[model samples]
Target chain A: MAEKVTISTVAQHAQVSRQTVSNVLNSPDVVREDTRRRVLDAIEALGYRTNRAARQMRTGRSQLIAVRIEPTRDGINGSVLDRFLHGLTDAAATAGYRVMLYTAAGPADEIATYDDLLSSYELDAFVLTGTDHGDVRTEWLAARGVQFVTFGRPWDNPERHLWVDVDGASGTAHATDHLIAAGHRRIGFIGWPAGSGVGDDRRAGWARAMRDAGLEPAAALDRQTPDGIAQGESVAGDLLRGDAPPTALVCASDSLALGALQAVRAAGATVAVTGFDDTPVARAVGLTSVSQPLAEAAAGCMDLLASALDGDHAALGHRIGPMLLQPTLVVRQSA
Target chain B: MAEKVTISTVAQHAQVSRQTVSNVLNSPDVVREDTRRRVLDAIEALGYRTNRAARQMRTGRSQLIAVRIEPTRDGINGSVLDRFLHGLTDAAATAGYRVMLYTAAGPADEIATYDDLLSSYELDAFVLTGTDHGDVRTEWLAARGVQFVTFGRPWDNPERHLWVDVDGASGTAHATDHLIAAGHRRIGFIGWPAGSGVGDDRRAGWARAMRDAGLEPAAALDRQTPDGIAQGESVAGDLLRGDAPPTALVCASDSLALGALQAVRAAGATVAVTGFDDTPVARAVGLTSVSQPLAEAAAGCMDLLASALDGDHAALGHRIGPMLLQPTLVVRQSA
Candidate 1:
């Protein structure tokens, strides 16, 4: 086996102290330009590898950003998170960090995984998704003084931390308005059961658009069920079979909209349908839906987290207000 | 800030040497069971987080497994990797390792990333996907004596390394057999262009199944195109418009199968279609598809990687052969 090239070897080759070599690798901003260049040259010439573990022990930074890989539930909407992850990985790479993935059964299990990751890997920070009402994960991390940025806004406490989210309410409202402009008076909403901040926000968008247009956003026209294609089909089927069936339906998700489309076909009714998320499924089936700027959202998340990690006092204090990006209505055949 | 818990503090509390504490954390098998328990207890009591970098410097192991996050090409088939990633993370956590993600533009760029990740992070091993003929990434890692196990088989040199792969040929053959059993003699195959090892394997299955059923696997019935829903739809539409179109179509991916379903609908023809991957889109549309046991495949990859990392001489030398898992056919309404 070849002799191992250590930091000491690089230091000797560069005619600098081991501490100088360490500084060149970890905190290059602190090292003199010439000295840093000489150390880097020596490292390249001698094939010296920097042990990040050693750097972590000295600097308490691992350059690792942890994100929970949520289980794929109802495959249609699942791609939404997957796309965000791809965007996040790309953004993190550009910012000189790597994304680490962990799995958890739920919120509590995710927290335990965070604790394990913190103790074992000393992750620099976390990027959380699926934020909702009273999310204990954020509180736990904040109390422990761990840095984190969420992809979804903290519904219960928006000012508590940094976040990047798409304007879901505006998205649904736009969809409803488009249907209304197309001369549909009786519009129905298919959404998840209330109490979920995101679901409620989306539901409100449809109702707000209806009221603004002088159309009654009747409770009888709204249908609430769990988010799934089958559930959407069942609920939409019920709505279609009811008295004075809606001429247009705005769904909370593409999965629900896809199901509603199937119900429309089965019943041979010409009802316009719109979905949220604009998932690939929506594109494949030509469903008009809301498209979030997920790549921008991911980059925004990295930006907020990077600022916090750079020891920007204002960012660390959560003074950088949450970033809310607009969603666009991608018109397709369904609506 | 609270007083930091160091290894020395844990050693003092456990009444053991610092080296003993280190051994308990990194190589507990070498430490006495009773002593290991005492050190662990002291670590928990004092909330002593293990400095993985310090441990890495001492033992040359970071307990990190790196994998390249492939860009989502066609969103339909992209979920396969996402599901595999989730499963791999779950499996790695159970094996005392973490999965780290890096992105690269292509094969050459990916190898460059491997070098940077290896030099900076000292990643213990790599988990590779999308293996192909004459893959330079494998050669580079093998030459440098880096430990890796591919999620795909090394088609050019099967004996050179460890791999875990789903039997694509078996999957397609099973799908073909199902179509044949249903009394369809003229069956067509929709697959990627022929040089890809996986695509070729799947194509061969359809031919083999046709030949076994005492039917000529007509070249006219086979169509090759790049993997995409639109591509699938166009090619299937062409075939459907041609003379003597097949009664059943088997696709290499769900994306293609979905397009074929659309083609059939457009032609107003009664034809059966089966897709591979059984992606959520497939499940949503009720397309019969071939499903690889991805969670099991992930566990298998981890098991092989762990065995290699355990310093098991036979495994390190590639004595343990590659693991070939069977794929099951998921029957749905499309077929």
Candidate 2:
């Protein structure tokens, strides 16, 4: 077997101390540019390999990020998750990190998976998504002093933890305002059953928009249903037959909007509709929807998580901004 | 901070040698039940965490599988890839292994990625998909003497590597036979542009089934074009305009099948169409298609890869069967 290259060999070749070689690899700014270049050249010449496992044992850093995903047969928003995964993966790669995907049946399984992964591997940090109220995963991770950043905000307790989420309320508010401006006063909202952190936030946006326009957001105009095409179609039919039918329908997701469009076509009625996530289905059908700046959000997520993983938690603590990103309205013929 | 527990500590506590402690952990079957139980109890009492870094340096194993996927926006078969990923991940998790996902720009970029990952981390093996003739990734990995298994069988160099793939020919043949059995002898075939290994294999199946039935497989009855719903619709329209319009269509993908359906509907004609992959759209619209046994394929892949990862290559070399899994015919309303 060939002799493995070591930092001491590179140090000796470059006529520098071992710490200088280490600084060139990990904290390049601490080393002079000429010295860093010389050390790097020596490393390349000798084919120096970083003993990541050894460094991990000493520093407790793996340069691996754990992203928990629900490998369900029917995810609520498959495309959104795919896009987020893509963005997060690409961004993590740019930061010299790799993503380890672990699937769970549900929230409890997710917590257990985290525990197993943390103990089995030296994972630097975790990226949590699909968060809801009183999330046990978040509580468990926080209690164990494990560093993690939730893709969705900490809805119940947001004071201590780091998080980044697209502002659902802001997105729906924009959509509702656009519909109202287009001369639609009786607008209805279709969303998931109330109490979902994101769903409720989106509903609140519509309510706020109506109030701003000096219009009473009628209770009868709002319908809450589980997320599915059939559910959306069924509830939309009922909403359309009410005493005062809504002229425009705003949904918490594209799935609901597509269903509402089906109902509209079946009833031979013309009503503008808006969807969320701006999934491929929305674009294919030309439905006006809110498109979350997922790539930007991912970059932000990598920034926060990378800082923590790089052992710069003090710098992360001082950084301030709304981690909530504003989703833009992609106007189409649907609304 | 507490003192770090090691195998030496467990050995002392269990009144056994260090090698015996290692045996209890790695090769438990060789250790007597009583000794194994004693070692386990000591491990539990002392909270002895295995030093993965030390073991990795000793064994040069990372227990991580690299599944390279092109994070493209318009994946030719996104849903198929997604299902395959789900299967691979779930099966890998069962074997106490984790999946590390990395994205690449193209085939050349993919090879470069494998090199970078191999040099940086102690990745045990790689899972290659979307392979083509003269694949550079395969050649590079093979040349470097790295362990890998291609999801798609090598079209050019089958004997030089390990692979697991769905039997595309079997799937299309089954679909053709079903259509023929349904009293539709004049079945038309739609597939991607010829020369694609999978596409050609699928087309050959339709030809084989027709030849077996003592029916002439007319070249004029088949259409080969790029994969897209619009293209499928356009080509189906062209095929339907022929003097001998087929009674049914067997498409290589659900996208093509959907387009064929649109053409049939527009022509005010009734015709059955079978698609491949049985994607969600196919199920929603009730299109009969061939459904690959992805889970089985994934299990097979994990079994082979796990054995290699476990340093039991001798067993893998002797195990034999057709790696090409036969897909099943999912009967839906369309056909």
Candidate 3:
């Protein structure tokens, strides 16, 4: 068997101290360019792989980022999270990191898993998703100084942590504008029951677009319901039956838009329906929807996380802050 | 920080050899019960953890299983693979194992990922799915003596390794019988294009049941297409347009059956339809389908894998040849 390469070997080969070698690898900019070049040359010559395990023993860092994913049995499958997860995995791999996936029962179980993984030195940081008001996961991790970043915006803590979120309001605004450009006056909004940060942002975008178009948003046309195709279909049916029916419906999710399309067809009514998240079903049925740049946002997240893992607290909070990428609208036959 | 407990420390505390200590933890039955108890007591007393990294240095094992999953963009989300993956993950966790997920572009890329993961010592064993005739992966792994257990049955080399598969033949047989019981004289069959082992098995089951019932299978009523709802709907529509239309339709998957239902509704026909997999979509639409015992199959895969990882190769192929669990019929409003 070949002798395993270690940092000590690299340091000796480079004629440098162990901490100098560590600095060259983790904080290259801190090291002199000439010293860093020597370390890099030695690393290349010795085929010294970055031993994440031994590095964890020395620096208390694991080159592993954990994402808590729940395997849901809901009717809506392969939603935005799946795409984001793929993008995150790709970005992490490119950054010489690996992703560890684990499922937990709820917030409490999730926190316990995080604790266990962190204490065992199995993970260096965590990636959070589905942030809500008073998110316990973020609060617990922040108190412990656990390096983490969220895929969604930090609803409660804006300055304490790092996050990458899509501009949902802008996405819905474009969707609403598209419908209005198609000569629709009665624009309706279908979204989740309102306290959700993402949902509300999307609804506000539609309202803003309506007001800009000199149209008063009617309460009779606007409806909020649990996210699902059936619920969307039923609510859309009810809204269409109302005295002032909407000629165009803007849904917060593709699942809801799917239901609205079915309702419109069932009622033999023609209406432009726009959905968020250009999901597979939306593409199949040709539903106009907003598509988030998940890969770019994921790349942003990895960049922020890499800075956090390197102990760049200032870069995370003050310099970079939260990244918000714009989502583009995909026009299809349904709209 | 307190001194980290290692295997050598545990061996010294237990008054046993390092090999014996390893056997006690990995394959307890190989060691005497009294010696195992002593090692367990020492492990508890010293709070010893079997460091997977250090163990790999000695035993060349990573204690991690790799499962290649494709993040498909198909409309049929939460397909059978997702359920099987969840079951596998849960079963692996229960057995003190971790699962590593990786994505690949295609079969060639998947094989390359397996090779890379194995060479890096990042994965101890692999779990294969979607096996086909002359599967390059099984051939490659078998030639290298790499430890692996397939979730799908091996079409080529049955005696080389371990596998667990649900009995598709029996599942379709029961579905066919259910249709017959419902007094459907002429039942149509909708399935994927031929040459697939699973698809062929299911088609055979329907034929067997029809033959057993003293009914000749009608060739004209049988249709084969790619697995999709739209294709299923279109093909079923074609089959119904034939001179002798079937009173009921038996689809190979829920996606196909969903399309069949839509076609039936459009035609205002009362043809009972049955789909397989019984996924969330099937349950939502009340489509009667076949449900594979995924949890049991997953448990079997893990058990076989555990035995293989423990150096008990005899337990895999001889004692427990490829496990074929029976799938049951899930009756819903459609059938």
Candidate 4:
């Protein structure tokens, strides 16, 4: 076995004091650039690794961010979170943080998991996803003064904490406007049942776009079901077979849009369809959809969390507003 | 904020010594069942979290498993890793471990990341994915005597380390056998370019199955291109347009099958197409695909890792053989 490399080895190799080596690894800014580069080179040559546990015990910062790995729901839409996580991991690495993943049954279970993580790991902060109205996870973290940021907006108290969200309403509105421009007068919407903040926001965008274009978004043309391709197909089949069937459909998700496309094909009807999230399935099937700037959102979340961890409470308070990124409308054959 | 709870607080509340509380949390087997229960109840009441950094400093076990989060490649097949990650997180929790994620450009970069993770975090073990011919990641970890397991087989040195792999050859063979049983004498294969262990394994299955059935596995009917829907479409289209084209196509991945499905539709050809991975896209499009038991594989990996960490070197040596899990062929309308 190879000899174990330690800080003393690195210091000896670099001809520096132990404190200088420690400073280079922990607080590089405090060391001279030449000295720091020499120490780093020696450490790299010796393959010296800092003991993070000891550092955490001293500094109370693990340089780890906790996030829940949600179960794969309807497989089609599940890729959205997967992509976001990829983006988050990349962004976190750039910010000198690693992502730690956990699985929980629901919000209550998630809160419990957070408690366990905080008690055991002393994680630097958390980057949460799937935020919704009456979210207990955010409240628990905020009450305990845990530094955190969410990928979704806090619907009830947007200003309470840092959050980065894509404008779903804007995304759906763009899809609707595109269809309206393409000579679709009677357009239908397929979405989840109301009460979800995200769902309501998406439906509102479709409604607003219709009203702006002086088209009636009649309740008859709007269909609601839990997000699924089969459900999308079933609901869309009924709408296509109904009186004054829609000339196009704006779906809340790629899963629903794929289903709607199937229904359109099954009905042998030419109905334009647009889906949200611009999932790969949508791309594979040539469906026009709305795309979120997931990488940007991830970077934004990291930036906000960095500020929160910087301990600049006054500046953080002033920067408490939500960061909403616009979604792009990806034009494809379906629309 | 409420008063901070410590080991001492739990000890006082449970009417036990601090060492007893520590034993209950770390080594429950050393404490009586009734005493462990009392300590746990007190912990629940006070919300006491173990200082993991201190514990790690004392025991050298962070109970963290590191895994690389690969970039989202060709969106259609990316869900496979996502599902695997979900499964791994769930299974790791059950095994009293947490999953930490990192990203790297390629094998060398991943090795560097591993060094960083090991030096700083002291991760208990790594769960690697995307193993292939001459995989340096596995070699580096093995050389260091790191406790780790891979979600892929080491193609070159199969018996060198611990791994859990889905039998890709068997999966494609089943798909081929299904087509042959349905009286499809001419079966075409669409896969990635040669040299990839996984792709080659999948192709080998089809060839073996064809020869076993006394059918000619002709080179003219086999095509290789990068894995993508468009690539699959282009390759499958050429095969379909060729002289005496196959009545069925077996693809290495769902993405390719999806493309082949498009080519079949475009050619107006009555062809059966099967995909591997049984990704959500395949399910949504009703493509027959091979499904790897991801959760079971995850559990298998965790079980092996737990054994490796249990310090039972003799038993672990006997259990060092690779765990090859069977893939289930999920039949749908595509085939």
Candidate 5:
């Protein structure tokens, strides 16, 4: 099926020449308002929106900020990312912005990859996702005077960076409080590795919540591991094997919560489990987790980067607070 | 972690260029062969390579070809497409091309999306995936003189297209032959809708293959249905439930094979199922299939595209045959 909203389809649907449709959208001053309305209605009905890539070439300034995405085999699909990315793309597109996806993988060829973009740069700015601490990629882009943004707090010099990170500490605090409110004092935490800035914030959020609740925040109650579905299960298994385990467990991500679910089932118990990043899988599997507006977060970062690209790095090092974003205690079978 | 491959890194490895390295590569007349060898050694030791995108940009050609991808959620991970895309990137990077991802979903707002790119072109051409018949996006690009290459033939006019198709007719024939060789005369086919040109090619291939084996292609052997994982299973289930069911089935894709697998298991009967595309699901379930050489196909399309972008469409309408990529019969318990 060759599915695309072609100009011809729009032309036929609007009962106008392809030239008229183009003229109406491109230079509306040349068309009458009545004719424009007919064309607009047809465009909307047939879905003949403008193509940004071509538009950006003529204008020499694009709202199409790019983000480097590298997903693993078992990771989330573009659709899941789209659920939020669409929100972001829509928000950007409506404002005349677009999100461009750049392939930034291959550790063995870093310099080669960066150097390739030196000529005829298309991205108005870039948002780096899955950025780790002390990331060379971020630094390389920074050196090139390219506008920069990161999904998570980048590993490099964070103080001088432009980013829009979730208030993880606050999100974890909310999750912990919710579990506590449910009459579960023996709260446990599942945090990610030290390298991830987002993970660290999440751990701190849990700790802050515990402190506010007048708990000691014992180290034994915290389980540190990599952010993965399998890792959560293995670690959760050990925690559940203990004679006195926490009644409610908080996880770093929905992916980890999936593993926690596995361990919960394996251990033959109903320990409440919660996670961060309420990914689509969480809903499919009914795992309650923190709901971060990933697309919104991505969009916020893009906005910041757009400004930065225009030499307004003043927003660099800015942080968006714990947006409760309807954390919707999704109260599934697991938690 | 800001990685910088300094001249010293290269020089220390080759004991050459604070300057001689540049001389050898940039102004060879200024450097002797012995010096060039020293500089080259340093480059090798430092893992230094030239950036193809940059070199191409110098000639107003970018090694980056944008692919408008629309990967869905649900069970579809776009893994096959991603693997293929990455393979193309790797291959193209070798020939000086990096793949950029563009999200052109529906016709609504994408026209502006294209318009935005004309002023800031970052790619030399566009490689379109997920295109259907009468795709306006393609036509729009063609109108604007944007060079594009596609994976499959468009429905309306295959003659005007430049693509590398899956050799569907041959692949379907192989799938049929595989079942026939395994002692199965009756073979059922689960495919996309009738009007779908690609699916029709597969059905026709099945017919030709069956005819070549002196077996009449029965109507009962073909079941055209909606495109999806569930539909594959449901249609295949219907075929299997009949009083006289085919001993083997040929499916359009691994996604459909997934459904077929479920159908076979649910019915408590075992029958062989072969699929096209040889997707990951097929590999996971060990289903017999006709493997499509995505990387090779992508490369061939890219070759034709690059030539066109270089102002030579002499080899348009070129059709590369299906890769007889040794579709392995895993001989698993079920299949």
Candidate 6:
């Protein structure tokens, strides 16, 4: 068997304390961008394989990853959850990990979910999603020394917890810039609620992109629509009906953009529209949108979680850039 | 510690032989329906649980469930593959199983794929989709004593092996019945290649419903051009150009359905559109369609797989009914 290189090896190689190496690993998003790049470079160069949390898995108990999925009640389980698992399962298989589904009724079910995973040695980590500001789950996990990574950023500056999230700012930037490049000036944005980190980041990106282009974005206060296309359409409809409507619209989600398209068409407006997450709906409609490499993100989580299983929480945080996948401006007549 | 239950306990409780119980577990689809139901009742009544496959798991070895994700990569990993994993993964997790993604470069790569898994201890079974007649992969796995199932059915007979799939027949039936209820007599069908397991089942249901209503079914051939929406739109256009164009159209997928709607709108035709799978695209466009319970189907796969893991391949073949899931007549302006 090959001698596994780990955090200690990387620390030694970088001529730093293991704690520093851990910090670099845990909070790369917070690390100065240059410092973050240096640490990541070292990680790749050193061949430091993540140490498996050997006890739970070595005990011959199948290690389970608690993947909290929106139950069928929410339309999320159909395709969104499905795509995530495709990446997650493939990555997990490589590390001899399997995912157990945790379906929550709502925010209240979150506590019970943690309790269930805690009781079982079968689970080594939790992959949380749909988190918001002031997230109680992150607080609980941090307090109990549980191994976890919330898919999106939590409201609080979570304490050196491991996470794999899309750089929503960049994703939104990609969408906004595309519109600007296509000779769209009076562009409007379809925003999500102010609570989510992704929503805020995306909104910020759109605003910044507008400011950068020497253009004034529409005075929309980020339409606080819920997840799904219906909300997108409803909000876009309101924007389209108003006098002095913008020539282009930006949505936080591809699903939402679909809604925006309907709104744009229904109001008999010749407006262009774009979205984020480059889902199948986006591709099917040729909606220009940013694509997040979710499979790779899911794989990165496994690489981090496996190290966390070794009792080194600080070795798990990974803040990779949302892959700058080229968002092709599919010039369908609708857009 | 609580005593674990085994196949023998289930057999004894069900008043059946161990082999009968094994057969019931291995090929649930083959067992008498009444007997199978009784066995399930007995297993539940006895609180019997199967042994976890921890033997191979100790060394981090695993049963590679060869998941065929037909890399249909047009820069996007296949969406259908993503959704299927939502169920396949959750089910595998419970049995301490893992799925290895087998990205077939093309149909040629399909035949020798299992050799890699066999040598790597990465695969113990295969879950297939987009299967056609004379698939060598299915034949290869059957010869290797590897457990197997197909999401899509093959053109061959029942003697080959086992599989559990979405009830496409019911999905199409629901769509057809919905259109018929909406006062549409001349209903057309725009679909994929005919005799495809997915295509055939949906067509069968549509035909049955059309015959029942004393209405002639529209052309059942693949009207789609190679590309997605353009194909649907052109087919729809062709159908509209026909002497007796249908008042409604039943499509194989939401993508096709979306195209049909675009074509209908583009031609200024008055035909309503209905589709299967109820993909997010269907909802966004408000095209009334039948939705398969993807989550439930995922759960069903897990249940059968759990039985298969227990060395009961017979009971693993039980058919889960395709849920109609209250297909709404989304009554949008087009429909």
TM-score of each: 0.86, 0.80, 0.74, 0.87, 0.64, 0.63
* Residues B232-319, model 4: lDDT tens digits: 9999999998989999999999989999999999999999999999887787778999999998888888888978887767766666
**How much is the lDDT of residue B266 in candidate 5?**
90
Chain A TM-score relative to the true structure, per candidate: 0.85, 0.84, 0.83, 0.85, 0.73, 0.74
Candidate 2 to truth, TM: 0.80
For model 1 the local lDDT of residue A158 reads 76
The predictions' CA RMSDs to the true structure, in order, are 6.3, 7.3, 8.9, 6.0, 9.2, 13.8
Q: Every model's DockQ, to 2 decimals? A: 0.39, 0.28, 0.12, 0.45, 0.11, 0.08
On DockQ, who's better, 1 or 4? 4
Q: Write the candidate numbers in order of decreasing TM-score.
A: 4, 1, 2, 3, 5, 6
For model 2, the local distance difference test gives 0.80
True contacts recovered per prediction: 0.55, 0.34, 0.09, 0.66, 0.08, 0.07
Q: Which number leads on lDDT?
A: 1
**What lDDT tens digits, residue by residue, belong to model 5 across residues A1-335?**
33555556666787887667667755678988988788778767764444442233235565556654454444432323444444555556544565555454564355444443433244566666655667777777778777766666654555656665666677788888888888888888887876576678789988898989898678888999976777888999888888788888998777677778789888888799997766545644567777766667756765665555545545433333331232334566566
lDDT of 6: 0.63
DockQ-sorted candidate list, best first: 4, 1, 2, 3, 5, 6
Worst 10 residues of 1 chain B by lDDT: B49-58
Assign candidate 3 its CAPRI class. incorrect
Better of 2 and 4 by TM-score: 4
For residues B168-259, write the lDDT of model 3, one tens digit per residue: 98998899999998888799899989999889888888988899998877888678999888898999999877788899999998888989
lDDT of each: 0.86, 0.80, 0.78, 0.85, 0.65, 0.63
Residue-level lDDT for A39 in candidate 2: 83
lDDT of 5 at A76: 35
Error of 3 at B103 (Å): 2.0
How does chain B score by TM in each prediction? Answer: 0.85, 0.83, 0.83, 0.85, 0.77, 0.73
Give every collision pair in model 3.
none
TM-score of 3: 0.74
lDDT of 6 by residue, A1-335 (tens): 55345555556677665555555654345556766566556666865433232222234333557676553322322454556665776677557565555545566556654653343223567888766777787778778777777666555764446666667777777677877898988788887777677788888888889989998765663566776777888998988777767888878877678889888878887888878766666666667776666776677777777776755545533322332222233444445
Question: Model 1, range A1-335, lDDT digits (tens) per residue?
Answer: 44446666678899998668777776789999999889888877875533442444345677789988887887788889889999999998877778998888888677767765765565899999989898999999998899999888999877888899988999999999999999999999999999998999999999999999999999989999999988999999999999999999999999999999999999999999999998878877789999999989999989888788877777645645548899999999999
